[model samples]
Target: MSPMGIRLSPLGIGVFCLLGLGVLYHVYSGFLTWRFSFLLGSRTGDTVDLRELLAVSVKAAELGGVEVKAVRESNKLNENSKGKTREGADEKLTRGDLLSNKKMANLITSSFPGVQVNTEEHLSEEDKEAVYWNRGIPNEIKEIVKNPKFVSSESITIWIDPLDATHEYTENLVNYVTTMVCVAVNGKPIIGVIHKPFTGYTAWAMVDGGSNAKTRASYNDKTPTIIVSRSHSGAVKDVTRRSFGNQTKILSAGGSGYKVLSLLDVTGNDQETADVYIHDTYIKKWDICAGNAILSALGGHMTNLKGEDIIYTGSDGNEGGLLASIGMDHDALVEKLSSKITSK
Candidate 1:
């Protein structure tokens, strides 16, 4: 009787103590794992501050604008055709496109190591030595988003269109050109930045972070104005006429980004504003993601002709055609065009 308790060998006591330590170690490790996951925004999908992402995206877009402007001013556009598109039109590419793509990608990747950046241009060895734009976010954006909110970075994809409207740029239609960046999480665009190199104007919006752009007044005219691509105008014009009557004002423009901005009254060329933007063929995700995010932020809508949401995560193109509108009924517009528009 060892002090009126069950007697145990020193070895047994040693083993018992070891087991207790092992259990404590396991519990401690699990606690640490949970804490780590929570901090990394894995546990709670709402852990990442979108403002930080917005700031980074704006900076990247500005840098991209710099590259685009530099190449154009240098008079070394070096335009080349990527190939004929599905519609059998020559797809244009230029030195500005590649250079801007490189600058945008490098900045976003370096700033947020965990983010995935998707660009429209492929880089060459010469792009490796491209000068990076080392600048901070504009104060205008900082003042827009004051309240702190978070989103998960797990499925975040940053879409960068280094130079939108390359064809227009080569043809000296620089006002239609832009450098765009869109922050999409899990296929849904939440942040968008459209920077005009030629005009020195930038428009950015985060889903809930706030925006500098405002929606224009509703199109009250019986015959609404619709903007379409300069290259893909034939099909859209026909369908739009059929859907909205022959009196619909149809304007032709280059760059999907420019057309979308026109809907918001953010035109670089001071051209006539349009009520809607319609595309009757396949368009790339990078072309529309920023616009989509901006419109969504302003309580507008951008979707396929069927009124379905455009996904930005996996595929590169939206084949369902486009119908983007602001300060009007998006569903009604979709209903008007969905059954009539034909995609090629």
Candidate 2:
């Protein structure tokens, strides 16, 4: 039959429609996969989860993978060569020491199988004893050990947990995997990272540091945006209104990683980029580490209310507060608002 004379059967038409639908579904699925893969791979997308990332990191480390390293014990050469030894370096306690000594290793091993726990040897018996008997360290002291880079600055205390929300992982196996990390100089966080594991969401920033601008610009349209915690809307509003004036527009966010990731959204297509200040009322060390890494790498500021730099591995692990900025006026902004924030 001539091409024009050939009449397609109803069965053929139905088959063709199914084929088209299948093709379309496949294409759509492929697109989503690509998008998710890209975001996860770059570690820059909003949907990325900090906890999951850390869990994966921990899992990889367990398998002898190199995605994550313990900051305290990993750099022994530098610690030894720098001649910077802690007070009881030889007699300091380690995470392993605490775990083994307190018989907590079995608990951690049972919860997170194959994951290695390495505690800093510099921690005094008191600190180790606390962590051993308490199951978790005080938030204040945990902040100090998380970020060791600021230990010498005398002004900075950086707290970082490549993985946060361990309880959630252990309890429900929920995707609420969070990485709690922050940098508090003078008892405040100038840089922070809060990453969610399941959703692939991340919040990161450098406050009062000149680095957040570039980092924000990379994810946003170069517009200054401040990220505030949804849970701390009142505190954020108070601080913003008092410091940036009531006219200052603030973006509300959830989780430390998500807040920082919002700043990285450069498109600015959404109303999320109306302003340029990212704020978190309260933050711990593990929630801000990776975020700090991103901000510092990008040239931003991360500090605490006292206008000090966040340090780590000190005898005392407490950091005062957290403050971050994405632009050049970070120091000026911190100085201006330092007096306004109520002491915690």
lDDT for each residue of candidate 1 in 246-315, tens digit (9 for 90 to 100): 8778889988888888888664455458889999788899999999999999998999888999999887
Per-residue lDDT over 1-344 for candidate 2, one digit per residue giving the tens place of the 0 to 100 score: 65798887889999999999999999999999876554333223223222222333323212211111232224321221213222211222223222222222222233323222322222344433221111222343234334322122344343434333232333333333344444444554444444444443434444432232234443322334456654434465687677766755666654454444444543432224433344434444445544555556456555666656655434333245566555456677677677777634
In the order shown, the candidates' Cα RMSDs to the true structure are 6.6, 20.1
The lDDT values for all models are 0.83, 0.42
- TM-score to true structure, per model: 0.83, 0.42
Model 2 misplaced stretches (Cα beyond 4 Å) = 1-177, 180-196, 199-214, 218-224, 232-234, 266-282, 315-318
lDDT of 2 at 1: 64
Which runs of model 1 end up more than 4 angstroms from their true locations? 1-47, 124-137, 267-271
Candidate 1 TM-score to native: 0.83
- Model 2 Cα shift for residue 308 (angstroms): 1.5
Q: Tell how far residue 165 is off in model 1, in angstroms.
A: 0.6
Q: How far off is model 2, as Cα RMSD?
A: 20.1
In model 2, the Cα lDDT at residue 286 comes to: 46
